[model samples]
Target: MATNNIKLISPDSKLLQYTQIELKDPTDAYLESCFAAIQQNRYTIESNTLVQIGQTNKKS
Candidate 1:
């Protein structure tokens, strides 16, 4: 498994946070698709996991 650290910043640019995501050798295309899905509200982070809306299984 590989871990990636993503920096979360506030809209005001005053606050910053970091989250670690684990994946199995994730590729750039996979990351980009995840970002797009998140922006579209198709996926969300819950309990340190990425879950697709309308689905019961978590995406790793």
Candidate 2:
């Protein structure tokens, strides 16, 4: 199953409509619901010392 025919023109070029898309598969999930994980980080290391704090956008 593969089909692709697209033609959309305008701006004095007329003929502005025609589309049929389905190339059997175009990478599913497509980003698994888009994406909205701006920034997230949590770290803590003992003994040797290491710490990071800058967490927001907790997805709520």
Candidate 3:
């Protein structure tokens, strides 16, 4: 199975949300739900590292 990697970016190309979806439970609605939850008060992913699980520059 393949994994789905998604990164939501802000208007400034900042990372607002990051997600990893497995084949078992990956859906557009699920993804959209995850995105909508943080539509407001979002932050850009100023910086991230490979070691980190996700990236969300909520303070950029």
| Best of the candidates, lDDT | 1
Total backbone collisions, model 1: 0
- Candidate 2 per-residue lDDT, tens place, 1-60, comes to 211232447667734333434334444222211111111224333363544555677765
Question: Per-residue lDDT of 1-60 in model 3, one digit per residue for the tens?
Answer: 222355547677756454644435556555555444545434222243112235556875
Off by over 4 Å in 1: 1-26, 55-60
Displacement of residue 54 (Cα, Å) in model 3 is 17
Clashes of each: 0, 0, 3
User: How accurate locally is residue 1 in candidate 2, as Cα lDDT from 0 to 100?
Assistant: 22
Which 10-residue window of candidate 2 scores lowest in summed lDDT? 31-40
The Cα error of candidate 1 at residue 15, in Å, is 11
Which pairs of residues collide in model 2?
none
| TM-score, per-candidate, Cα-based | 0.44, 0.19, 0.28
Ranking by lDDT: 1, 3, 2
RMSD of 2: 16.2
